[model samples]
Target: MNAIEIINLTKYYGKNRGIIDVSLQVKEKSIFGFIGPNGSGKSTTIRTILNLIHPSSGEAYIFGKNCEKEYNEILKDVGYLPSEVFYYSNMKVIDLLKYSASFYKKNCDDRINYLSKIMNLDLTKKIEDLSFGNKKKVGIVQALLHSPKLLILDEPTSGLDPLIQQNFFNLLKEENKKGMTIFFSSHVLSEVQKICDEVAIIKEGRIIKIEKINNINNNNYKRIKIEVNYKIDDTFFNNIEVTNLIKEKNIYTFMYKGEINSLITKLSKIDIINIWIDEPSLEEIFMHYYDEKM
Candidate 1:
């Protein structure tokens, strides 16, 4: 069963464009990434899927059910963490969580307890007293308390520290392992790279590429770092299909997505002191799409 299906999904705010004919499928029990820069329609698409805002055209489905029409029914099995975290400021964390749990049918006490402990959340603290990061932790715990089958997160690590972010990613991986499908939307390419099984690159409100993680990391993309005997012009390295090229004095770094033979032949012509070519990070590959017209 597919986790989510968005077909020709377009949203417009009055005369302004949100997304245009956007379409994608997130497989069941997989970590799928929806990546783009700010104002690239990530939030618009997500809100449309959740039926928080009706689409201008086309449809969204979750677990084979129409999201707009059946949201009341479908949302029961869905967990969501928005890009921003907000809660009743006066309530204690435990109280807020319990109130949220009331909306679901199942008993989530054990689930909340376990998630809170692992997330290092102090439930006794009042929501008003918590820092931004702590508030985010509460949001995570509340979203997962019901053990929903579908998880939707948008820039979930915004206020979290590096250690907490890693812990959150590991928690998400564990949830995915247990057959919870995830739709993660973010501008942080590194975080998405660490966990997603597949990635869809969105540019100017349209998808430019949807590829498996392995294919993107291993094939058709290489991170090249070169130490040359002399300064190299940016245009000199432009002969090949390179995405992001940077030259700081004698060291040149960039991502290449063409035939290895071509890159090797080009490097052979130059007086190279040392060269290292390896798998390019998703961030490196994303820069190709990011630079397009907004």
Candidate 2:
């Protein structure tokens, strides 16, 4: 069974478009990445799925329950960490966490203490005294305290430092091992590439492509950079399979996805000083999708 299913989900705010006909399914026990640049409706899609914001059209399902109509029941097994963290300034971190835990039926004290130790959060400090990153830690603990079957995170690493970020990723992996489904939404490509089993690329509030990470990494796309003895025409390497082609002085760079022999055959005629070809990074592949004209 799919953990989450969004069917042609679309949302609008007044005249502004939130998402347009976005459809995707996240498999059970998998880490799914929803990637897009800022303001491309990543949050909107997530909000719609959680029924935090009503969709203008279409619907979403969580564990086979209608998200909009049965949100109360669905939320029991769902843990959510929004992009922004907020809390009462005067409340102690521990007190605030206790309050959040009260909403769920099970005891989360042990889970809370364990997560706080891992995240290095100071539960004794007042919420107002904590740094932004520390507050984010509190949010993280809150989200996981219930040991929810599904965890949804939006821009989770925004305020976390590198070491903490890796630790958090490790924690996520551990959770996944226990059969928890994770929905990770972020604009950063490398993190998504590293953590997600499958990723859906969103641009201008629409999903352009969805693929497994292995297929994306193992695909034949190559990052090619050529340095010739002299300047060359910009279109010299133009091909249907080439994207982001650019020429600056004696250097030419682009992403290619086709037969290597065909590319080398054309290069054989040119006076090349050096040529470099390597697998394209996920960021480059993301650019290739964004750089395309819609």
**Top TM-score hit:** 2
TM-score of 1: 0.92
Kindly state the number of residue pairs that clash in model 1. Answer: 0
Q: List candidate 2 stretches off by more than 4 Å.
A: 233-235
Compose the digit string of candidate 2's lDDT tens values, residues 22-66. 999999999999998999989999999888899999989999999
TM-score list, all predictions: 0.92, 0.94
Query: Worst 10-residue stretch by lDDT in candidate 1?
Result: 285-294
Candidate 1 segments exceeding 4 Å error: 230-239, 292-294
Using lDDT as the measure, the top candidate is 2
Clashing residue pairs found in predicted model 1: none
- Per-residue lDDT of model 1, residues 217-284, tens digit only: 87878888999878776678658777677778888888887789978888888889989988877887
**lDDT to native, each model:** 0.89, 0.91
User: What value of lDDT does candidate 2 attain over all alpha carbons?
Assistant: 0.91
RMSD of 1: 2.1
